[model samples]
Target: SLANAEKSQLEKELEAEKEEVETLRDNLRNRDKMMKDRIAMEESNRQEAERRMGGMSKKQMQSMEERAKSAEEEVEKSRKLVAEMRMAYTVALVQSRFLRKAMEKLNLITGVTKTENQSLSLRLSNAQKDLNKMEEETLNLKEELAKTKEKVAEAEEKVTHMKELVETMEEGIEER
Candidate 1:
């Protein structure tokens, strides 16, 4: 029963861990998709700026360059965030695997312990039964011993009565 309880608890924890891993994976995928979309949008903006720069005034061109620089910085930041997310995903995956393996090992150990506990319980039950039988036999032997003592006392009384009768007969013969 203890083993079953422990196994069930472990299974629940494993399930929770699996759910966490799945959630993390979903989050990572969503972030990756968003990052890709942003990169594509930045690329399109750069192309449009290039097209405008050809016929634009000096100040307009300078403004476009600044916007382009700002876009590059945003893209770099997105890349860094994606890299961090990937790293976090990898760590979560490794940790999930480790927890699964540990849980499996714990389940195995619990099974073995349950088996051993059952075996010991059976052995203890059998030993108790044997002890009860021995005690009963001892009680029977004690009763038999008491009966034998009574019989011995009766035999001794008969032997004394016979000795007195022999003495009385001898005394009567001497008087004759």
Candidate 2:
């Protein structure tokens, strides 16, 4: 019974760990995609800004210059964000790797559990077969006991009949 309960608990724990690992993997995948997309988008925006920098009036050019400066600053900020995102991605990857390892461990435990369950099932089957055999033997013993009782009863009756016959014969002989 302890083994049965322990097996059940282990199964539940393994399932929860599996779900956790899947969630972590999904997060890692999403973060990787998001980082790549952000980097590509930032590069495209920078190129477009550079091309537009060519067409402008003197006054408008001054404003354009200021805008360009701001854009550069924005780009710098975006670069930093990308760096941070990359770091975050790396961290996520490391965590995902760890989670994968944990999942592997869980898989190993499940394998052990599978074997244990198989063994327990085999043992139970053997025990059931033994029990069946014992029940059959008990039935045979009961039948044999009943037959022995019948034979004993029959033998006792025959002995009584012989005794009565002997007494009757002796009386007849004495009377003569």
Candidate 3:
């Protein structure tokens, strides 16, 4: 019963962990999509800036460069965030796998132990029955032994009385 309870608890926890992992995976996928979109937008903006550079005034060009630099920095930041999220997701996945394996092993061990315990219990019961039977046989043998001793004692007493009578008869005949 304890093993079953533990197995149920482990299964519940494993289910929760799997759900959490799925949620993390979804979040990671969303972040990846966003990162890809931002990268594409930044590339498009860079191409537009290049096209406008031909007739642009000095100040305009400077402003465009600054804006492009800012966008690049933002893209870089987004890349870093994506990378971090991926790492987190990977870690969560690894943890979930480890927990699953551990739970499986625990279940296996519990099953084996339950089987062994049942077998041992059965063997103990059989041994107890055998001991009871042997005890009963011992009691019967003791009673029979007592009866045989009584008969042997009676036979010995009769033989002793007969020997005494024979001796007395011999003496009386010799005296006559």
Candidate 4:
């Protein structure tokens, strides 16, 4: 009688714990789905914003400006969602790691572990390279703009000098 009662109580506790795990799994799944959708939408919006940043007609600029603002807002939302998801994922991963450690202690099989360390490292290296390229591009654009401005100022100075010479010649003729 005592052994059967203990077994029933243990089964009830196990069932409750299983339900809790399932709930957390469901939450993690939903968060992941939302994160993926938001990232995809934001990627498109970001591309549009980048295109708008390039040269355009005045009217086109005005339209792009309005769209850019809206897209920026969307990107902000996406960033926030991504941040929340990253936090959630970190927490979940930590929990899973703890559970795996516990299972190891209890002599149970461990869940799958990441085996793509090299792949991850390579991707990060590539991302760094892309960042460097963008930085160089921005620097080149700034230098070009500075040179163009200097040329415009030089042209303006030349025009002013010509106007002064014309006035001086006209005054000499008047005096003669």
Ranking by TM-score: 3, 1, 2, 4
State the C-alpha lDDT per candidate.
0.49, 0.45, 0.50, 0.43
Which tens-of-lDDT digit does each residue in 5-29 have in candidate 1? 6545744654564555446445545
TM accuracy, model 2? 0.35
Candidate 1 local distance difference test against the native = 0.49
Per candidate, the number of residue pairs that clash is: 0, 0, 0, 0
Could you tell me every candidate's TM-score relative to the true structure?
A: 0.47, 0.35, 0.48, 0.33
Q: What is the descending lDDT order?
A: 3, 1, 2, 4
Candidate 4: what lDDT?
0.43
Q: Which of the two, 3 or 4, has more TM-score? A: 3
State each model's C-alpha RMSD to the native.
Answer: 52.3, 49.3, 51.8, 20.5
Error of 3 at 11 (Å): 1.8
* Model 3 per-residue lDDT tens digits across residues 24-86: 545545654654565465456546644653454556545554554555465455445545544
lDDT of 2 by residue, 97-169 (tens): 4434444343445434678757755644554454444344434433443443343344334334434433444
Candidate 3 Cα lDDT to native: 0.50
Note the residue pairs that clash in candidate 1. Answer: none
Best by TM-score: 3
